[model samples]
Target: MNAHHDHTGPHGASPSGDALPTGTTGFTDEPQITLRGPAELADALPYTLGFHPTDSVVLLALHGERGRFGGRLRLGIPRSPREWAPVAEQLAECLVEGCERRGSRPDGIVVFLCQDPGEGESGRRVMERLRPFAQKLRTACGALDVPVYEALCLSGGRFWSYCCPDSDCCPPDGTALAPPGTSVMAAAAAYAGIHVRGSLRDMEARLRPRTARATVIGQERALDAASAALVHRILDTRARKDVRDDTIRLARMLVDRLAEHPPLADQDTSDTRDDALITHEEAAELIVGLQDRRTRDRAAEWMEGPEADHALRLWRALARRCVGAYGEHAAAPLTLAGWVAWSTADEPSARVALGLALEADPEYVFARLLHQACNEQLDPETLRECLRGEREARAQAGTRHAPGTRATARAAGARGVRRRLRARVGRSRGTAQGAPSTGPGSARPAEASGPGVGAHTGRRTGRQEPCGTRDGGPGGDPSGAGGADGSEEGSAR
Candidate 1:
């Protein structure tokens, strides 16, 4: 359903003078549109979320007397009715507490249960089935002292309201939603350059592992070869810095390649083309190398401007390459994908990717910290500024070393070691010197230890550090080789 603006109100304000809900940056100077009733609210869901949610329970916080929208939370609906009560309580607590942390306790809440009916089931039946769940949600919110203003069930292109009892306006039979792009909200969104980014499932599919048997097998084999070739060297202290440098360099090169080749109009075709650009060997080596927290943070520097756009696509492609036993290794790339998405103001994609990262490895400290910050609606610039400062310090340090100085000699020695390792990897993979490898057995020339290795050398137990420390390099670790603080250190494999 779509919402039409009642033009009687002046300056894009509602009849009550409330403005449209703003994002993380707060209200903007752009004109606001007001929505009235369940039909209009259902129509505004996709635009509010930046995507259409399927099989989801969405709770939106509304503040003040004008019912201005605030933070929102969404989760997949539990399949079992027995699971509804506990899930409802958790969702209610999460939303209310989260809003409080942001310094805005919700004045009221709006609930939306969106799902499609099963075969031979009607929209009315779907509404009836979800009725108890809706009541549980309202009851949970009311217990927190924030009442649910409205509860809506959207299914089969129709909407049913539980708060409104009148049959004339809120009929027993569900009301059909307005046609797509036909509402006043749609027109205002268009004029303001706001576009709905399709469905959540569709956005997530782009980052999932390849399903083709051949592709999966090839990637798995490549990962195995890379793990065997690089894990030991990565664990060695002398070689760790070189490995980090190589990983960052290769990632930059790949980002440039993606930037040069723009995405096609069709998303599927664009993903396929992106997949083709990086060979199985390249993807596997990068994935394995990125298990290093320092390496991952260095790669994260490409989170803005033209480079960020391509870097995000590269991260997504890399995430898709984590297959078989190497699936846990995807935490690095997926976290990077989430960071770039958040930096670019794509909160929906960031949340999905970060969620997947935690699923891959729940103990991933970087992912945990990033996920929490994103959820709190903290501006990503805080992290970005920290990264930028680290990058500049590294640059200045390199320039400080003069010709034939001790630092220069050490830098040259590191490069020579990297060259020797590349040669060794090439010989092991049976590839010619100085040529890119293509076979599944072929691996990236330079490699380092995974995140499981050397990550907590100088870190204190049970303490979590931010993304980057003001004085140290990435991971906020002075040693610059361990995972984020509080993470267990071990072998990546």
Candidate 2:
């Protein structure tokens, strides 16, 4: 999630002279709308988080007397209420400390608990069930001396406030949310060109692996064939470079192919067209070859312009192709998809993709770094500059070295590239003051690990060496690239 405050500017009162609600914030130079009560607060949740959260607990920090919005955090509501207390405590401290590091601790906090009812359960029952969870959140925030001014449970189209005791105003049966696009917050958001990107589940479904049995079988078979053909060459010292080059060549071709065909009006149809554009064999080759960090980093150079727009689509397509035992191979393409999304200012998708990348391989260094950076809201330009520099350095080395000695030069270039990238990453981490840790139970940057072998460990396909490494050649650079991938797995980890 993008933790940066959504609104930061001078405040204005509502036409009725009402104060802005605890959660709503103003956009600079845009028409400001005053959100009056729980109704407006509930309606503004989507705009604040950039999506309609489901099965999630959102905490928005408020600063000063007028309640200007500060940092925000969201986590999936724990299934077991037993876990709610600890989770609430962790979330409160994370958000509060984060705000402090950013310059001021929040003066107040607002909590939103959103979940749809299960089978045979009414919205009121849902609210009643989650009432204890809301109390836990309130107590957690209160423990830190930052009170939760309002706590709401939104379920099945109706909202109930834990902080309000007046049944006449809040209603014991719960009040229905305003019609979409009719709320004052919705109008102001639309005027500012801010759009809610649907529910988190919908955003994540786009990158998930194809689940149809036929598609899975076909894609898995293709992956097996590609692995058989390419793994040996990738492990061969002389052929590794060729494999990397071919991978880059194929990826660029696919990006161009996707760019040539504009997205169809319907997203599902557009995705289907994108899938059809690349043959199963082509996707398998690219997916298998991207295990090489250098190749994936080279492909990441297309992070802007028309190239990025199409590259994101292509990456998503490739991620969907990582099926069956090859599921873990998705870390590469998913990371690329996340990078492109973050670079293009699509934080929701980026977070989803990066989270999925970590799910694929928790030890993935590139995904971890990128995920942390995105969570911290670091300027994507810093990472972009690092990639551009690495590319330039390689180009210079290729020209400077003799043909017979270019391999040595390339190896040196790779080392230098890693150094520069790592330096930039370190600088970003240092500068991101008070940014919450990547996930719960951890407060440090993700640990770096060597590239993981393919997930099909039982098959014993030769020595399961990291990609880009050879028996007697330069080993794979443990520092891969700097970026993360995500999934909508109920948490941003």
Candidate 3:
């Protein structure tokens, strides 16, 4: 994870036998501190990933003689023994080849196998069980000519090194890990204002499926009611403009409300306040209303300034409300959450939200595109610029005929309004004109010619009523199929 090098000297004896200090720094401008042994490295893992990695394999790429850390990759440890080799090989190839692509081949690699002990099992036993997998990893990297500098197993509050042979330091029972925040690395990180939030599990919990059955049932019911009420308004061709404009207006109102009550510093309090501020019914209505692609795209304009943070909080709160049978309905809110997080430079949360979005609906086009962009490490500014340009264009067009004599003004305003409407219709039609629909309800669009994020939108057909409707009746299964991740039911996918 360290992206920079330092000239700091080690004050203590390095871990005996090939456990050289990881004398590398990350994206910070501060001087690097040295990690002498398994203990320090174990402590450094959280700092590296911004959260403690659990049941994961972390590969640290070491460059040159000083072993300056280069790139780092982490993946959930494969549970099946048969799959370990392939995963190891893939990890090795990705880190090694990826480094080479950037003009430097890693001279060495450091591997950390982190897993907690099962009930009644000791840390040593966990380490023993993972020995083969660690070996596979080392061998995989070695095959690419990048020797594993150190291979360590961290479990049961202790660490065991497979590469270090010094029994005094890396004992057979494993070395007790240094207490958190006591290491030189921790001190340096603190000096730089870098804080490791908590375990990855803790961070992900905020976005995970809530299992409170009653709450989920209520939200599902609300969703069903919202769907029943809004489906016709959203799909009726004659009312399309009104519906679209209303969706946008409601979205703006919510953003303004969120802006008035920004999140408090205490996360739990902030979340509670957010959930309380927006009612279940209101949240459900907006969630269903956002199914329109155009509506969601228009709302995406709330990307920066004070409104952006509040907007992000709103999306997150909505995401949390997407419970149980309404899980797939999370796609829109989750995508918006991810987009705002990414726009705000919170990559970890962005990746987590976007990944969960895919889990909710694998075929969700916006989620897929955002996930791909995030994984590829594309600059968020690229997408931000596109959105900003679109917003600016819209603003300029709105004011293009602001001033004139009353009669002339009326004519110009009418003509200007017509021009804008035509432009909007043309853009929508151009994107979806002849594209085939997906399944029974969804439609696909060609990529927009102008710069934008998603190449296609998933548009559900107007012919079918929203999922909760049965035989054209309002009363149907509350736990029915639908989505609220980003846009309209019949939007371009």
Candidate ranking under lDDT, highest first, comes to 2, 1, 3
Error of 2 at 78 (Å): 2.3
Q: What's the CA RMSD of model 3 in angstroms?
A: 11.9
In the range 207-311, model 1's lDDT, one tens digit per residue, is 878889999999999999988887786777677777777878888889989998999999999999999999999998899888766677678889899889999
**Residue runs of model 3 more than 4 Å from their true location after superposition:** 1-30, 231-241, 401-493
Name the candidate, 1 or 2, with the larger TM-score value. 2
TM-score of 2: 0.80
Model 2: lDDT to the true structure = 0.68
Q: Residues 1-493, candidate 2, lDDT per residue (tens digit)?
A: 0101112211111222336533232244434455566787788888776789887788877676666566777766766667777777777887777667556777778888888999999999999999988998889889999888778899999998887676776778999999999988787777767788888777767887889999899999999999999888776656877888899999989988988899998878899899999999999999988876667777888999888999999999999999989878988888889889988877767877877776677667677667666655556665566567557656776778656354454444444434444554455432221223434322222211100010011211221111121110012233422222111011011
- C-alpha lDDT of candidate 3 relative to the true structure: 0.61
TM-score of each model, paired residue for residue: 0.77, 0.80, 0.73
The TM-score measured for candidate 3 stands at: 0.73
> What is the lDDT, from 0 to 100, of the residue 221 in candidate 3?
87
lDDT of 3 by residue, 1-493 (tens): 1111111211112222233334323333336456654566677767766677677777876665555565566666666787678777777877776566435777777788888898999999999999999999989998988788678899989989887666775689998888888887788777877777676566656665556787678888898898788877767656655766776777678777877886788876877787778777888888877765555655766777777887888788888888766777787788888888877767666766766676666666566555544433445554554455445545655667555333343333232332332232222211111223232112211111111011011111222111111111011111123232211234412
Error of 1 at 432 (Å): 52
The top-ranked prediction according to lDDT is: 2
